[model samples]
Target: MPASDALEGIQACVFDAYGTLFDVHSAIGKHQHRLGGRADQISLLWRTKQLEYTWIRSLMGLHADFWKVTQDALDFALDRHGINDPELRADLMEAYLKLDCYPEVPEVLSMLKDGGFRLAILSNGTPAMLEAAVKNSNIEQFIEKNFSVEEVGIFKPDFRVYQIAVDGLGIRPEQIVFLSSNAWDAHGAAAFGFKVTWVNRFGQSKERLPGKPHFTIANLLELPNLLG
Candidate 1:
């Protein structure tokens, strides 16, 4: 379907951080020389574990802040890959703090802001991480709010996590246009009543989840055209 079909009544725009806007793989990519051929494997494992930890922790009612979970996930990935350099682990964690936003992020966000949409980032990232990333990406001016899962102590696919955006913006669920690169995230928000767009940058398969996104776009650059 054309992206423009999803723009009808979105009063605010909420985004997912790690993969949707920022390039999460860039952290591992920065140290490809140190990781050698294992760079891609490590990056994949790190993200897989990072997300799994959140879901597992949430299900078990065991809450660890995202930063801690991020490190723990990294440790598991490094161990699995048999790359045990303490400095490299620390460097990878540090690199995450400044992941690069997608090349189209700044301009698209500026366009959305100029169009008078309330823009926010609702992610599982810790406030410190979010702040640093936003500042480093130089898109802080385009964001009106940053809603971290820390507020609710849960991760995405959970209703409360999506509720953060609703509460933070003081808008009904249907009024928000929720965007995420994760298919499950888009489904979750859709189930919660947000008009969702799954930014399928990798062209991944559809999720076997409860809800479906109203639209799908390959990149943020397609977003502004959709909004109007």
Candidate 2:
């Protein structure tokens, strides 16, 4: 889709961090010896459990920051795959803080900034994690703010998490463009009444959820055109 009036009235852009702008698997790819042939499954499980923990914790009213949830999920994945090494765990955690950003992120973010839209990262990541990842990826110059679930001590697909953007940006929900690689996140944002763009990087099917995105694109590069 090309840029059009469909993006009219958008004053801010809020993005999900993990699996969206950053390659969540890049951290595991750096540790081939530890993961070996199970790298893919282990990576998938780590992410799956990470998200599951967030939702479960939210529902149980027992909240932990995303960093802790991430570590817990990583531990589960490591144990499930029969890989046990304290040093490996440490390395993986550190790698996560500096996850490799997608090649198109920097340019796309710059383009958005140049287009005069306010930009922020609203993520399930903690403030420290988001700060480190943004700085490490050299996108700090483009983003205007970072919003973390830590502020409310909850994970996402929750209305409260998405509320941070509307509240923080001082803009109406209809005026913000929320983007995510995860379909659930897109659905959540759409339900919250924000215009949403699902960056369907993996060619996943549309979710059968309450809210649907306004647009679906293959990557961040397509975002600029969609916003035009």
TM-score of each: 0.97, 0.97
- The residue pairs in collision within model 1 are none
lDDT, model 1, position 200: 98
The C-alpha stretches of model 1 lying farther than 4 A from their native spots are: 1-6
C-alpha local distance difference test of each model: 0.92, 0.92
| Candidate 2 lDDT score relative to the true structure | 0.92
Of candidate 1, the 10-residue stretch with the lowest lDDT total is 1-10
Report residue 225 deviation for candidate 1 (angstroms).
1.2
| TM-score of decoy 2 | 0.97
Question: What's the C-alpha lDDT at position 133 in model 1?
Answer: 96
Clashing pairs in 2: 3-225, 3-228, 4-228
lDDT of 1: 0.92
Per-residue accuracy of model 2 over 154-207 as CA lDDT, tens digit each: 889889989998899898999999999999999999999999999999999889
